[model samples]
Target: MTNPRQPHQPRQLSLNAFLHDTGHHEASWRHPESSAERAHDIEFYVEQAQKAEAAKLDGVFFADIPGLWAATPYRPTAHLEPITRLSAMAARTEKIGLIATASTTFHEPYNLARLFSSLDIISGGRAGWNIVTTQSEAVARNFSLATMPDPAERYARAQEFIDVVTKLWDSWEDDAVLADRDSGRYFDPDKVHAINHVGRFFQVEGALAAPRSPQGRPVYVQAGSSNEGRAFAARNAEAIFTAHQTLGDAQAFYDDIKSRAARFGRDPGHVKILPGISPFLGDTEQEAKELQQYFNELTVPAYGIGQLESLAGISLGHLELDERVPVELFAGSGDVLDNNRSRLQVVANIVERDRPTLRQLLHRLAGGRGHNVVAGTPLQVADIITEWFENGAADGFNVMPPLYPQLLDAFTAGVVPILQERGLFRTEYAGSTLRDHYGLPRPDSLYAATAAATTA
Candidate 1:
C-alpha cells in the first residue's frame, strides 16, 4: 500500500548570491579576508559556486556594466566575462543556477540567443540571462554612437529584441531531432522551422542552429525599476532584481510590477521579485554594527563624492562634505525616462527622508550601491528576511556580502540555517534546472501550444 502524506507546506523563498570581485563594499578589497587581485582567478569563482551550492542556495548572479563606472585609482574594477566564466563553473558544480548579465543594446539577436542557449545546455538547464539596456554614454561611444541613445528608444528596441529571441528559441520543436539510425534519417525537417523574424531593430531569416535546451529556453531576468522597465518585465521577465531602501517602497514596487503583469494577461505569481541586501554579520548586534562602521571608515571621501556627483548630475566638489546637500541639486537633472532617473531617485529619497549630510549619505551608500544594508547577528538578519518574505515586500533577496568569501560564508553558514529551521527555505534542491530552483515552470513553445489549442 502507498503511504499517505500530510498537507502540503507553502512554497519556500528563493535566494541568489550576487557575486563581486572582493564584495559589495566599495573598500572591500582592503578587508583582511578579501583579495582584489583574485577577481580574474577561475578557481576563486569556482570556490564561491561550490560554497553556494553546499548551502543549497538557488543561484549565483554576476552583474555587468559595459563601461567604466568611476575613475577611482584604488579598489578592484576588473570582472571576467560572465557567460564564459559560468560555462567554466558549470563543470565544477551541480544544481546551482548560473545567471549572467547581457546587454540588448550591443548584441545581435541571433548571436545572443545562441550564446544563452549554449549556456543553458552546458549547465544542463541551469542558465539565466539578466537582460539590460546599456546606458552609459562612454559605452555608447565605443559602439560608434556620437551621443547616448535615448532611454525611450532603448526600451523600445529591447521589447522587440526579446520577442525575436523567444521566437528563435521556439523555432525547433522538442522532438524535431528523431535521429533514426536504421533509415539513416536525421532531424525531421517539418518539426524544424525558420523564424523569419523581421523587426524594427533586428532581422533574421533562419532557424536557430541549436536544438531545444533542457529548460526549453534560458530564464529571462530584468533589473530596471522604471515604468518602461516594469512594462517590459511584466511582458517578459520571469524574475526581477531591484533596489529599495524601505519596506513601503518595496511593497509598492512589488504590487506595481505584479499588477502590470496581470494587465498583460500573465499570471503575476509566476514572476519572482528579488531585492538586493548587503548584510554585515556578527555574533552580536553590537559587533555587527561595529563591523559595518569599520567598512564605512575605509571609504575614500573623494571617491564617494565623485560617485555622488555622477548620480546627482551636479557638481558637489566645492561643497563641504559635512554640510547637508541641497534638495535642489537633483532638480531638473533626472526624469522618469532618463537613464539616471531610478538611481537618482534612490538618493533623493534618502536625503528627503533623513536629511543626512553628504558625508553620512556617502557612507550609507558605500556598502551595496543603493540596496538596503542590514547589520545584525544571524537571527536578527533572519528576522528582517522573514518579515520581508512574509509581508509581501519580496519573494526573495539577492544576498550580497560586504566582504568576499568570509561574509558570504557567514550568511550561508549562520543565517541560512536559521531560515531552513523556520521552514522558510529549501533543505535540498528540488530539481536539476534553474527554473526548477526558482520554482518557475519551464515554458512551452509558442508554436506547439498554438497547435495543441487549435486541435482541442
Candidate 2:
C-alpha cells in the first residue's frame, strides 16, 4: 500500500509529533492545565499517544536522558524509561510510529539491538530507534566513565556499535523458526547464522537471541547536528531530528546532509530531516504573544544561568540577571563551541542579532533551546509549516508543544486540518508498520535469502 502523502510525489509532507512528558518549556509544569505530576504515569503517555494517532499524525517520539538535569524547582525531572514507555504506548496505539531515544554511549550493542528488535516484534514493526551519542558529563559518571569522551571518539565508537547491532539483527533467517508439531523437529540450525563482529567498541560471536523482526530492523532515526553527527546520519539515518532557529539555517543543513548522502551511495530522499518546532497557540496573535510571555515569566533564571554556564564554559551565577552576557566568556571557549557546534552557533547568533540581556536569553531559550518557537493562531502556524515544507527547508517538523495535550490538541484540531486541506499532511494512516507509514520498503532478510539460495 502506498502512502498518499509519499515524498516521491510533489508537495507531500510527513509530520511527527514529539511528545514531552509535560511540555517542552522548562516551566510548563507551573501551568494550571499541565500534568507535570503525571510524568511517571503510564496512562498519561498512553493518552497522548492515542491523541496523536487520532490526529492521524505519522509518528510519536520520546526524547530521553540517562541522567537528570541538575535538580531544579522550575521543572520536572525524569520519568518512565523511554523504551518501556514506548512499549506501553505500542499496546495502546495501533498505527502511529513509536520512536524512542537510546544512546550508544551508555548501552551495549548486543543488549540495545535485542531491545529494539523485541519492540519491533511486539509492535508488529511500528518501532524506531533514535540513535544518540549522549554528551552529558553527569551521564558519563553514571556509566562509570571518568568523563565524556571527545566528540570524534564517541562517533567512532557509535559507528562500530551500529555495525555490530545490524549484523546481529541479520543473523537469524526469516524461516529459521519451524513450529511443526507432527514432526517434533521445530528447528532450522542451518538457517540461523552467528555474527562474528570484532570491532574496536564491541565483539559479539553469536547470533541475536531473537528471530528476525517484521521490518528486519527498526526504523533508524538520528538526532545529532555536529560534523561527525551529520556524517553518521548521512550513512545510516532514515529520519533525522534536528533543531534550527531559522529557515536559512534549516535549508543549509538540509542541503548539506542531502549532498553528503551521495558520497555514501544513498538516496537523499531516504533521509527525512525534521526540525523541532514548539508552538504557542491562542485565539489571536496578541493572545499568543501574551501566552508566550506568561511562560517566559515563569522560567527560573538560575536554571537558565546554569545552562548558560555549561554552554559557554563560564559561570554566570555571579553575574547580574539584568546585565548583558559577558563577551569575555565566549572568547576562549572554542573547544566548548566546537563540541556543541549547532547549539553554540545558535547562542552566538542570538547574542549577535538580538543582544538580549541575561534574563531575555533565558526567556528566548525557555522552550527547547533555539528551535523555532512561534506563537499564533492555528492557521498562522500551518502557514509557517506549509511555507517551510513547500520551500525545501524541511521534509517535515518535530511538533513540540510548550505544554502537552492542550497545545498538541490545538495543533491537531486546527493546524492539521489546514495542512490536510492544503494536501500537505495525511488525513488517515495508509499502512500498518512504521516502515510502511514512512513509505519505506521492508529490508530484505539477509540470512533468509542466503539460506534459500544455498538450499536451491
Model 1 regions lying over 4 Å from their true place: 1-8, 332-335, 454-456
Task: Give the local distance difference test score of model 1.
Answer: 0.88
Per-candidate local distance difference test = 0.88, 0.84
**What lDDT tens digits, residue by residue, belong to model 2 across residues 122-176?**
8888899999998888889998899999988998999998888888888887778
lDDT score at residue 340, model 1, on the 0-100 scale: 67
Which number leads on TM-score? 1
RMSD of 1: 2.8
lDDT of 1 by residue, 151-203 (tens): 78999999889998898898888888888998787998877778888779988
What is the RMSD of candidate 2? 2.3
